[model samples]
Target: MNAEARNARWNVLGLLPAQLIMLATLIVPVGIIVLVSFSTRGPYGGFDYVFTTAPYRQILFNEGWTGELEFNPQYLIVVARTMILAAATTFICLLLSFPVAYFISLQKATAKMLLIYLVTLPFWVSMIVRVYSWIIILGNDGVIAKTLHALGLVDNMGSLLFTDTAMLIGLVYSYIPLMILPIFASIEKLDPALVEASHDLYGSRLTTLRRVILPLCRPGMMAGSILVFVPCLGAVLEPILLGGGKTMMMGNLIQLQFGAARNWPLGAAISIVLMAAVLVFLVWRGLRAIRRERAEAAA
Candidate 1:
């Protein structure tokens, strides 16, 4: 019908700006990055406009070709370290978020709003400031180390700053709220009657939580997890600052390639690998979520 066609056209028109913005900001930028990752740079440190597989090769074999450039297990170990750090940060954030979210969910009218506001208030600060704040707090002269020294836990302040532990702390501090928000959103939307019914069936709190609440919360859990893990995986800033700017993570290595090492090709290659890793996680999470939804429907 003409009317149907007109309505469809209008609907699409309404979506046009959003689609354009998505393309401009997300799709276009990502496409350019991917394209650049496949190409090489000129000696002047700019794109050479020459396309080649040198970058991809560099990713796999970063020995004399790149840096301490011999095919080395050390590079792989650095990548593994980044992975472990990301995984640990995600896990800890997830674990902490649930309890905080549950506490918020148990609150009443004004209290719930206040608690949520308080929880999210920290997000108002710039991420850079938030990250750098940890540097001051965890440094040798920082409060915790100084306190520990005062308590005679050690004669000197702990070398707490610029270490793996500091990196983890910064990561967790940065992302805990992200994990918390989604879980809190899910918890907020949960039906109290369902929980009541579970309790009515003589289910223990633990059993009800394990069987009912956690399953219902999977979508949010998955969402929170993806948010945390994706950014955490390719993290550079925290590791660079708190991890002492060592060969700590892929992010750090990629920075080294493009900047200090003057090897744009190698940097781009590593970026592509990290992007692929992100895509894999996203796809896996999507599949899991779809299965969860189907299972819930069947139930």
Candidate 2:
């Protein structure tokens, strides 16, 4: 056999193990969830073998005794709320990450490494522990509440915990590192000559950022957005802990179905829906990236 053909065969053989692992771990579990989504609920809260569309219908409508379909907004509201929370978190992270990334990118080598380490330092701790720390900081008798009271901003130690603001704070804190790393990577690779040229042309700093830096950083921003948004949509811990279970996100709803509600089929259906939505978003982003690359090449 030719050397090229032998090399190709070896490459495929090298990838075979990873392909099998992915199939076993990801594909199999997702396939099981999809199958369960179309199943019927048994008398005792488990799934039955019978196939049915009732779980999907439950997400969209209320069925009358006589089988009339009435539009229901309960699950719809949850989905919308999830989307809004995810989108807002992604946007906030994007805004916050850029400046930090830019600063890091401009730093000397030692300082840059130190700054990058600091940015990722939070990951060394367990996520649950990190979230719990916010509870102490935002609690009624915590630093924020005491400071507010001391400043006469409040009559008492008003807690920031268990509010939407608290939830958002946790989400942003948890995901900001994910956002920053990608942006920093992009900015690090950016040609300094481009910035120098823009300045030589007498472009203002803001103008340069808007016209040059942002365009070059688009891929990183998109990557960071996807990383933040998708996971935020399915986040249960932050909403539950910070929002005090008062807020109902899609993840919380799914957890409820599987745990308290004891409806496996419904939970599986919700999981499927969430996965499909994420898949659609990924496809859209991927297509946009491809188009942008094509445009850049043509230019």
Please provide the root mean square deviation of candidate 2 (C-alpha atoms, Å).
Answer: 1.8
Candidate 1, position 26, lDDT: 92
Query: Can you write out model 2's per-residue Cα lDDT over 109-178, one digit (the tens) per residue?
Result: 9999999999999999999999999999999888888888899998875678999989999999999999
Model 1 pairs in collision: 63-69, 63-70, 64-69, 64-70
Best by TM-score: 2
Candidate 2: where is the Cα deviation over 4 Å?
A: 64-69, 151-157
Q: What residue runs in model 1 are displaced by over 4 Å at the alpha carbon? A: 62-75, 150-157, 295-299
TM-score of 2: 0.95
